[model samples]
Target: MSQDYDKILKENIEALILPLADKLLGLSLGRLEEIPDDIQTTLERRPDFLKRVISSNSHESYILHLEFQVKDKAAMLNRMLLYYAMLKEKYGESIKQYVVFMGRRKPRMSTQLKEGMIDYRFSLVDIHQLDYRKLLDDATQPEQAVLAILSNFKKSEVDTILPEILRKLQALTNNERKLRRYVRQLEILSNLRDLQKETIKHTEAMPITYNIEDDIRYQQGIKYRKRQRRKYRGNY
Candidate 1:
């Protein structure tokens, strides 16, 4: 994937994670109260999504750090360990971390660091292993509906599920700009499952009117193009 598209996907995923933190974390941590804007680390490294969540009973609170990885990278375990140390330095042992893998290939990353004295570990979740129908059933939030495209959907169900998700997205918003943004996100996410063609077909068929300039991703693309142009001129 292009670097620009990668950035946009990460940003969109981060945006969705914030609003749907409860639903996502509920998979492992049960009910939680997200502490907004409490994720800054001492080393200036920000996790993709971080929040101090309080249990529903209000008795326990812990920092939940989540990172989204498009593909397995070397030193990922070390990086996660660094995050664990930093978060632990600030929040003590009351921190739980998870890395959500969104790559197409099966994940081959290690989730633990067991050296002579270090035995740190974190949870690794493969999106493909998750049942996307659960997210689709969450009708209250359109973000979940959009994310369902990235989850585990059988090849046979693509035609049925993709169109239904697009329709739900369309019904969730009437504003052209927001609708376009959601459509773009849905399209990008669909790439993870190789359903981009189907996503585009359904999105283009929607009747929403939107200007390309209104899209932040589009504006970013324009800026990148201009920068490339300037660099090309400078080279000559």
Candidate 2:
């Protein structure tokens, strides 16, 4: 991934990718805790291109791989099948395979020939289909707010419908513990990335602006003041 694309990926990992992965792949906080160590390591140590993998509790499991494809390639299934084989070899047999499609548009699924045997078993999730409007109606209050904040990248266009989004977010934060965790994670990641980008820009234009002493003072004073407010608020 190019630097710009990588930045976007970093931004989306917590906001969009992780949430969607959890939703479609049946990953919850409790479920994730049950994954075996070897499988967990494989997921954690995926190559630069691959995003994640998930497995179920039953003996039968499917490996979910995330990729960003600009254009559909002919050998996509073949490549995924090969990855499945590699994973099986690393672990033992008795593992299924799936490749998640995360892109601007939906991808056309194609059949693959595996040594003259046919195999076409994978899943695709076009992020574009996660429309804010659809989620607003179908999703619970928490999910609705999550979808809205997750779509912060599309804020300008989405701002028109944000009254409901804000309502959902506020409601979710007050009620759902799990969703509150997700929202906090998303906020932390987004803020860190934004700060990183701003720091990089300032360093490139005026290097001396990268003043750690001043930053530490500001953090201690301003951030500490905000943290102290937690005592006054019941929900904080």
Candidate 3:
């Protein structure tokens, strides 16, 4: 990743919006599979560029075009319209279009008003609007739990609420369970808790490869997965 503002923004989108797409749009992508082919370089420039183009066979074997916007800007709907038109022109109308906004605050979106236009408009997901605490309360509902962690929540909060959060997260869809286990494994792999001041002081003398961002995200994914697994195991 480029050591620039775009890199930070892209990382946040990878950790935040991509998961939302899976939960809300029924689309899934690998950890580093988000680099869009059509407009990869443009996105790194923080320009209002396109995200990715992919094909899937989940329901009817269609293409997935995804965009991750960190903040709101002028003429967003117009840009959305342009993206839709461009993708359809390039890949035919059969490809599905999905644009998600994980901005800190929700923006007012104008209704699609183009005449004779039949296209899938963007879907907005405001990170600030998501309630991680409420999702933790609904751990029996793994989907919401997954949504909660995947949404934007402070790291400090995750630490304090982990146990209870884990308790509620144990119930999710079967596929969600499998994904949860994968997340748990990442948490162990990241060993993020070792970043604590106490731990850091002791480990400062040694070489550490743990990245706080990776560990937190790994824990979040694991929590979502573990909750589903627990639900499947009937431990709820």
lDDT of each: 0.72, 0.45, 0.46
Pairs with steric clashes in candidate 1:
none
Q: Could you give candidate 3's per-residue lDDT for residues 123-211 as a string of tens digits? A: 65554444566545634444344334434455566555444444454434355434344233323312222223422233233223344
Clash counts for the predictions, in order = 0, 0, 6
**Model 3: per-residue Cα lDDT at residue 171:** 37
Clashing pairs in 3: 139-168, 169-227, 170-227, 170-231, 180-225, 184-222
Q: Write the per-residue lDDT of candidate 2 for residues 147-236, one digit (tens) a residue.
A: 443332353443344445545555555544443343333333223223333322322342122334434234557777787787568575
Ranking by TM-score: 1, 2, 3
Clashing pairs in 2: none
- Candidate order by lDDT, decreasing, is 1, 3, 2
Find the 10 residues in a row with the least total lDDT in model 3.
186-195
The alpha-carbon lDDT assigned to residue 92 of candidate 3 equals 61
lDDT of 1 by residue, 1-236 (tens): 54534565456654466434545544434454545444453545466777766666566778887877887875678888887776676657487788878888888888887789989888887767766776777655566677788777787888888888877887777676777877887877777778888877777777877576764457769989999999999999
Model 3's alpha-carbon lDDT is: 0.46
